[model samples]
Target chain A: MAYSDKVLDHYNNPRNVGSFDKSDPRVGTGMVGAPECGDVMKLQVKVNQETGIIEDAKFKTFGCGSAIASSSLATEWLRGKTVDQALEIKNTDIVNELSLPPVKIHCSVLAEDAIKAAITDYKKKQGVLTPEAVAVH
Target chain B: MPPLPRDYYGFFGFDRKLAIDSAALQKRFYELSRQWHPDRFGRKSAEEQEMALEATSILNDGYRTLKDPVKRAEYLLTQDGFPIAEQRGKDVPPELLEEVFELNMMLEEVKSGDESARPQLEQSRQHFLGLREGVDRELLREFQRHDESVEASPTSKQALQEIRGLLNRRRYIENLIRDVERALNPVTPSRPAPG
Candidate 1:
């Protein structure tokens, strides 16, 4: 299927494609995969502890073009946003921005999941108790 | 005809169990083929001929799907309300995902002309193949569990759930193996010239 120009652009020149030290207290790492398609995406965010803002974001995704573009766009949207704002980022937004076809909507969903996972990791590292963490406990 | 017997097992006159006898299934397939062959209904009413055509279609599709163990299990899963394709990443264990991600990175390296990583990629292929074999063995055991339990009972449902997880892992390993093989032999013809 032909990808939208935006997806192609991001895919050809993925932004913030790398990783952060998972062990760093200020860094949150989210690793997600789609076993159906054998796609793995790792997204990370480094937060400014005092400001509660995400100072930087990075990602490495191994999958189709849509998946790469989704994660790349996710990282771009993540930087400069506060943790709360980042949490507000939705899969639908990614889908719309990338103009992903129905079948590729899962790629956007994976990106949104990666974003939430990264924030959760950051929260846990900061000892912030979220309902999800409490539920897990 | 006759609503296509509801499912492949019923079409083949077998119980809803995973332990199918291939010989018997093959015999039944031939019987059904003869019974539904459109040619036999040439002189029948148009409606009967239409019904025969539909039955033949289902018979062919069902036989192909049920003949393979993996495909049979997947079909049963969907019939049992466990849609395999709709399962998400959370269905997979975290450790497995980590290992898959690392392997994918290595594969990318090998594909990008880093010949130094070829040996490691070969090792990874063997490791994944071993994993795939282990999964196959586990599937066989689970199939027994599924076949032994009363249909739709709690035990049967639990067995189906276990089978689904194994199938997911197996598919992931299968994809990795295919990728490794392709990367290892990028230029080799898919079918070597007759030797």
Candidate 2:
């Protein structure tokens, strides 16, 4: 199937693809997998404790082009934002941004989930979740 | 949980337990597929062909569900009780829904920003893993007791319901983690993408 231009762009040139230290206090990591498909995804966000801004983001994934594109889009959205803003970023936004098909929506959903997992971890480590955050990370 | 036909275990010709013989299961599936598969009845009458297809589909479904423990548990729970699809009316605990939503959001974040919250992602994995492990253990215990009973009990009923919810929730979280891992760690991204 011919993916939308946005998906092709991200798939062909995925961004912010790497890993980070799991022990870092400033970082929150979410590693997940789809056993049904034998796919794995890892997402990370470096939160600025003082401001709760996501100073940086990264991911390492093992699946298809849609999965790659989704993760790529997630990292691109993560940089230069408060964690709260990052939290607001939705899989629907990524799907719209990438123009992904219905079947590939899970890939987009997956990327969005990783960001939240990472942010949640960061908040959990901070020892207190702000009332505004709901601390679901 | 995946839906399985009644008497699925009987079709597979095995005792109900986590310790299923993989090789036997595969061999039986392939053989059944060869025997009952619609492809073999392509030249037959329409009624015969339809029967062949139905049989093969049932065989495939049963074997697939029995092939994996997580799936098996989920299938058993679903079989024992109500379909989770109908549980939408009830209020699920916030903790359960929260993790599922966040796991999805992180998948989007890490895709664009590499190595941003890698640590946090791992932490989430650990947390979910812990939760899943506990749930899994609980399921095993329930199943064991269920095996010993002459008939189902109220406790088993409740446990299976909870198991169904956990399994469905886990499946969602699992999908997100896979998307991130596949995107960033593709030494080989050559496989077919998910639909």
lDDT of each: 0.90, 0.71
For model 2, residues B104-136, the per-residue Cα lDDT tens digits are 566567776756767767777677667767756
Model 1 chain A is weakest, by summed lDDT over 10 consecutive residues, at A128-137
Could you say which candidate leads in TM-score? 1
lDDT of 2 at A112: 73
- DockQ for model 1 equals 0.79
User: What stretches of model 1 exceed 4 Å from their correct place?
Assistant: A133-137, B1-6, B34-54, B191-195
Best by lDDT: 1
Query: In candidate 1, residue A1 scores what lDDT?
Result: 83
